[model samples]
Target: MRIRFDNTWIADSEQAILLHEPGHYPVAYLPIEHVEEGVLLPTDRITTHRDLGATRWFTVAGPGRRGERAAWTHTDLPEHASVLAGHVAFAWRAMDGFYEEDERILGHAADNYHRVDIRSSSRHLVVRAAGTTIADTTSPVVLYESGFAPHWYVPRTDVDETALTATQTSTFCPCKGIAGYYSVAGIPDAAWFYRDAFPEAARIDDLVSFEPDKIDVFLDGKQLGVEPGQTVIAHGLDRGLQPDEIAHRDDSGLHNTEGQQ
Candidate 1:
């Protein structure tokens, strides 16, 4: 893995540790020795981790840029967490990019436990909003993702195009590229589709999925509803994400599912 910031490579390591915490994405912690010389400048700021102990902050410096308090290390780790003693984790959003070899990793570090599976199904699925039929299909693809309910995606040909209006909203997923939103039947962001998903999620490309809470969705004659606490907030500037970095669409049209399981 490699970290780039300020148009410079700050760190690269082949033995980075991926630390998973509750209710959060995994973080990549690289050995302190792998980081470029003079890139991490110690700061007076300090914080504490519930399990890892006292954390020391640092200002990450590059050729002509500096990210204040963008890197951290556990100074007083518990005996059980001693493996992280000589490592530091850079604030993911603070860095320009994190890469596995030449391919860039978006959203966050790839979680080993997170999985996305796509399966073709012939289940009848229908979507409705404002008393108008938005989509209907029997050839839907079901996407089963870790920690999320199954999402049935329908081909655009089977959807009522007049009911959908492209919206200005966009979201990024590390496992499944970027998702573009659409307003359906006057409901804002009631539907979404991945025009150009990453390799792992290429099967549902250009397929639309409606929001269960904002619209009526039915699968196999059974009405579908949003699972408790299943709403996902879009990643935006507040999370330090910029459009140019994560919203670039791929036009290769490859449906390879060989990466990021």
Candidate 2:
């Protein structure tokens, strides 16, 4: 997925760019910018590949060099068999083995409830499914701000952990962070996390778990409340609500919710 060029960047750019390295298995390069400008010297050379043909090459200039020397051919290319390792640069990869249309239709009518909450204490907005509660040093345990949907962080000691057990699955979120998993035996995706957390989100360090969107999210046998519509960034320092480009809808089109039925 990703590879680092110990030290190199494209000519004069300040950002350390990661370009898609094409091949059998695509790899990327992250050269130090300063090094590229001062030391990368082009050579009058070109190589061909059996699968993709006409690969280019370059050389680094020595300290006292006027030009360049020493070429290391680019190896490790992508091929049909190479897909197994997936993308190294990608933190996680979906292995559904189907195109967008096929994958989307696989679970088209799946029922799930998505909930988002902004903490009053931290003001950090967390997207989570309704009904799940996190535990920690608080009365009602908090939830972790992890998963595909955001959920606010709640302390762990405040939750009832009797209904959960650790699971083998794991996931990474660039926004929130990596998560450890827990699940209810008969339920799918009722995974809860603990142990690791997003750095600034200390509030949920050891106190969160999620109820499957398909299940009723509850607290100590009590049902957690749900909203009839999508949550909007009503009031905050960020000012206007998010989804800036889209209009708001009432309870129906946004996400589903659960209550004591």
Best candidate (score: lDDT): 1
lDDT of 1 by residue, 113-207 (tens): 98899999989998988787889999999999988999999999999999999999987776777789999888999999988777779999999
TM-score per candidate: 0.89, 0.36
Candidate 2, residue 91: Cα displacement in angstroms equals 12
> Which regions of candidate 1 are displaced past 4 Å?
231-244, 248-261
lDDT of 1 at 5: 81
lDDT of 2 by residue, 97-200 (tens): 11122111111111122222334343322222334433332243344321233343444444455656676666543223456666544455565554544444
